[model samples]
Target: MKKLLLDLCSKLEGRGIHEIIDRLKLYYRYLITVLFYKPFIGEMGKKTVIYSPIRFTGLKFIYLGAKVTIFDGARIEVVDRYGNQRFSPCLKIGEGTSINQNCHITCAEEIVIGMNVLITANVTITDIIHPYDDINVPISRQPLITKKVYIGDETCIYQNAVILPGAKIGKHCIIGANSVVNIQVPDYSVVVGNPARIVRQYNQMLQSWEKIYQ
Candidate 1:
């Protein structure tokens, strides 16, 4: 009970103050934009979500998970002339993880990503594949591709990683930066390079079949 009280007091004192400070910063940003760029807004009452000082255009659709943050220059494009992107709603992110700046995650099918999944800069997650049977038709006119991609809990994906359609990555897997995965990766494995190969398999002292290197 004493620990709980201490925790509550900490939240009330420190966390509350930090939130107030963040809001102050946001308010200052709004004030500067209003004063300098008043001609652009034309008397819009007030801005709720703040935009970047630089013109980094990409946050448009479906951001879930209240703790989610898209960094400076990070791109999350979910719509186009083809149709209202049916992709943003297809992506799900778990708790305590971050997708860094310049990452592009495009989905046409469901993508269930697990908790503590660290996705670094320039990581691309796509579930669509286009048909190349006919060159006469535009790429946009190609067939809608679908294959669900599931990344298990505690997985770490590095910069420039490309997770293609239908790839099921298991828990605690470490995918090296700039790796291109086109197949399923087993749990607790380390994969690297294009069409990634497993360089290491996790050891289990219990001698379980599920833990052995495949």
Candidate 2:
């Protein structure tokens, strides 16, 4: 019996039983978070998993679609009132979209992210901009200027990219790593650099991506 027990233990160790236990714990945590937040969220679709250690504000204004997964350390906020300003904000994250760790998304008016979008780690998507028109008042205390931000279907935003107010990213577009996008990006284009500009665009007639030289 002792030899049989030792053999079973050896097999379990080789199978990485510890790793399986850790994964089970993580899934349990995710289940608890979903059950707690589902009642408060404006709309929580089926199979939407929100990982633990997330920072959320105005949960009632945020809507998440089916199979949307938000990883750990994400800060998602919908500001209905800030610094003497009142807003009716709506933040909608579409089906199958996955937001990676440490992404910050804040909206004061409207921000819509379309289906199957992949936002990598450390991305910031915001629709409110702090106005510093008055030099006498600090920027933190100033009123926010908000515009609608839209990201179309199947777009991929890479790590550390910032999507600012009034930016519209079209379908199947790619926003490169560490890029800052504050303008409109047409469909099937790849944008890179600060104040992101389209570096490559798909030409339907040629059935290929053509490089655009600045």
Candidate 3:
């Protein structure tokens, strides 16, 4: 009996037990969202479901809209630029948006996520960039640069994508996996690749996407 129990324990130790515990914890998500998360946020609209075990900070500057669902392991922070509470509305997520697991979003200035946006797992969205121009000062000690990142309504950002500072993604746009977006994306466009470029754009007159080559 002892050997049998030890063997079972050894098998369960290999990721299976951890996954079971995580699944079990999901049942209490609503309770955790209301009791632990709601009060600290800048704004939280109705019926917002946030999966637990999320790493959250600077909640006073973060706003989440109605029916927004944030999955497990998301790290979200609204950092004060100077470590002072001078900035208001650092992050804003619009209604009906779903943010998948393990996404990291840190904002010092402003990050506006518009309505009905879908952000896949492991995406990184940041409005602040570390300054490294000065040779004398360490990069970590240098002052950071802040810009606004705007993701428009109905946009879909795929897994492992990075939305850098000053990116303005328009409505109905699709950002492909592992892409880096640093510029403005037009409405109804499909953007892909590193330093993401618009590969296809919808033509209203033709009612179809026109392939773009450059």
Q: Which candidate number would show the highest lDDT if scored against the true structure? A: 2
54-105 in candidate 3: lDDT tens per residue? 6788988888999899998999977775543355547999999999999999
* Full candidate order by lDDT, most accurate first: 2, 3, 1
| lDDT per residue as tens, model 2, 1-214 | 4764465456557456687576556556557657798989999898788885478999999999998988899999899999789999999999999999999999999999999999999999999999999999999999899989999999999999999999999999999999999999999999999979999999999999999997
Q: How does each model score on TM-score? A: 0.66, 0.88, 0.84
* Model 2: lDDT to the true structure: 0.91
Better of 1 and 3 by TM-score: 3
lDDT of 1: 0.66
Residue 51, candidate 3: alpha-carbon lDDT: 86
Lowest summed-lDDT stretch of 10 residues in model 3?
Answer: 80-89
Error of 1 at 11 (Å): 9.0
The C-alpha lDDT values of all candidates are: 0.66, 0.91, 0.87
Clash count per candidate: 0, 0, 0
